[model samples]
Target chain A: MQILIIAAIICLALSFFADRGKTIAGIKRGGVMLLRILPALLLVVFLVSIFIYLVPEKVITGYLGSNSGAMGIVAAALIGSVSLIPGFVAFPLAGILISKGVSYTVVAVFITSLMMVGTLTLPLEIKYFGRKAAIMRNVLSFFGAIIIGLLMGVFF
Target chain B: MWKILDNFFLLLRETIFFLPLMFLLIGLFDVWVPREKIERHIGYGSGLAGMFWVILLAVAQPGPLYGAFPVAYILYTKGASVRNIFIYLGAFSCMAIPMYAFEIGFLGVKFWFLRLIFSLLVFVSIGFIMERFVGEDFRVREGR
Candidate 1:
């Protein structure tokens, strides 16, 4: 995060040297956008933290680990879509699931949906891309995850 | 309560730290990149090549998924096609290069390779599907 901030500052400084007025204008524009999205950002972080707290990892693994049919894939996809686990944790959990005999399809759907769909981030997404586009993207990605999972089941 | 608050503050701090830099960079993108260039590369007529460009752009970007939203917004204003924007979002969410390296480490090279191929196929189709639903007139709501 510090690296990103430093890099951004350096780029901004370079831009300032190239054209001062445009650089100022860019900063002002960014400031407006930051203020606009602040409420949604705060709300989402709060809600996600609460959700993560309420649902322990064991419960999530229990749900995904137990089921094994078509229902299992759906369950895994749903959990993945809603859960806030980071990639580091999610991939390891997925590895454990595979070792536990979960079908490739279920694990595939779980990881794909976790990465592609963001139920909690919808508020922030809507704030930027509008209600329609944001919702459509998630809906599409959900189905996409399923399709990808099914194909993986066929291949592996 | 304390746990939730602690988690909340941690997530909030992460966002607060990273998002401004995202916005600042996006603002610079909006200012420096000409609309016509964006149009030519990922606009209405950019075709299949546009998808390729967006996937590469998405891979190059390094950040949490939320950071991609504002960049997508700027791309839209600069006249990137709806399909291309959706593709960008899908790729940004799933196909990031750094994330791919981690995925390969945990899931094995075969799993990572197959998932990427499948994800690319599905997301390209999703992008096309969303273009139909979202269409050209979709605009970010003005008043919060």
Candidate 2:
């Protein structure tokens, strides 16, 4: 909240130099842009809320253990791809997975996929970058996650 | 009805908080920043310097993936190279600097560094591939 205020104040101040008229116009343009993206952003937020709160944690951790093997990696990749939990939550959750004997490699895949490929944001991504770029990036990152996982297994 | 509204209510606070601020910045940029200025800095001839420049910017920002989309589209319109913009999004989501210290503490130094290195390489490759796949005609004015 403080950060937003600071940014808002700075923008207003800077706009004085940029042009008072243009700044007001900018604020209006910003409002319209906000409205344009609102529906899609809300959809993503809703999906993230459901996936995080509704899905059983045990189901996730259980299938993601080291002994869980290929399926474990796949499960981790799938969950990580969609769940847009913050870094604090995600890293601690990942650490717990490692401690619980989940494969380090699987955890690597999980974190990599979680960060790089936002499956939930596909609508917004497609709306901006178009279908081919959005789909390709996600698809490639999925495989890249698997490769990183395999490498981690070999190295550590 | 209850379930749907329940979910909506749950996320309403955050949506109200962040979206306007994001759009405000975007609006400011839209109004003030010159297209030629952006194009020269991060556009076609900018080369590796542009990728690194954008990565630094992406790392400095602390926002979710959706936030990057609009900023990226703006950059693209203003003449950022296709590949570099994609790399920026990749770095923004994958290896954000705000999250770096936290990541190292939890994931350990070796693990974090390894992921960082590999993710950068993968994203650059992805960017080039995307550049080829989408080609020059993908610009906003051309498409519109």
Candidate 3:
């Protein structure tokens, strides 16, 4: 809340000096874009809320920790690619998972894929970058997450 | 039912912080930033310096990956290279400065740094692969 306020003030101040017509047009355009993505955004938020109860730490630990191996890495990439948890929650949650015996690689892949690949935002991406480009970006990011996970697994 | 409602409100509270800002900035940049400037810096032929420039901007600029999409669209429409767009998105999603700090605090400096290196390495490599995969098809087929 505080951060957004400060940002709003800064933006208002910047526009005070910048062109008024352009600024108003920009804000209106922003609103249109918001409408476009609102459904997907709402769906993701709804899923996350339900997911909090459905996905327990024990469940995550079971699949992503201990003896879970290469398959764990793959699973982490897949799950994380779809999940859209915020950084504030994801980092701390990931920390706990790692401390509780989830391998660092799994945690890393989960975070990396969660950030890099966005299943929830696919519609918006397709609208902007076209279907082929959007799909390619996500798929490549999926593999990228796995490769990074493997590297982290080997090194750390 | 009440649980779902309560959860929805909580999610709205958080979304309020990010979504508006992301959209406002995207909208502002769309109108305010000139197309020519984007092309000069991050366009198809800008090469090494452009890659470095976008990565630097991506790391320094603070926002979620969603904020990046509109700006990237603007860049693409203005003729920014596919490679540069790939790098920009890669860096935007994976290399947040505050997130890095958080990672270090939670996971230790060595671990954070190692992950950071690997993330950048993979992003660049992916960028190249995407540039090839998307090819002229992206340029010809898509228009904003």
Clashing pairs for model 2 are: A66-A102, A66-A103
Weakest 10 consecutive residues of candidate 3 chain A by summed lDDT: A1-10
Residue B25 CA displacement from its true place in model 1, Å: 24
User: Residue A108 lDDT in model 3?
Assistant: 87
Ranking by lDDT: 3, 1, 2
Taking the candidates in order, what DockQ does each have?
Answer: 0.37, 0.32, 0.35
Per-residue lDDT of model 1, residues B1-144, tens digit only? 799999778765644655567667766766776445544455344577767777777765445677778778777777678888888888887886645434554566778889999999888888888878878677753324
* Best-fitting candidate, scored by TM-score: 3
Q: TM per model?
A: 0.63, 0.64, 0.66
lDDT of 2 by residue, A1-156 (tens): 455557667977889786899999988987896687566656665665565456555665567765678898888789889888665446655664565467788998988888788889887777776787778889988888888888778778
Rank by DockQ (best first)? 1, 3, 2
- Whichever of 2 and 3 has more TM-score, that candidate is 3
Off by over 4 Å in 3: A1-60, B1-45, B140-144
Clashing pairs in 1: none
- The residue pairs found clashing in candidate 3 are none
State candidate 1's DockQ: 0.37
In Å, what is the interface RMSD of model 3?
Answer: 8.3
Ten contiguous residues minimizing lDDT sum, candidate 1 chain A? A59-68
lDDT, each prediction:
0.74, 0.72, 0.74
Q: List candidate 2 stretches off by more than 4 Å.
A: A1-62, B1-44, B140-144
- Model 1's alpha-carbon lDDT is 0.74
Which consecutive 10 residues in model 2 chain A have the weakest lDDT in total?
Answer: A48-57
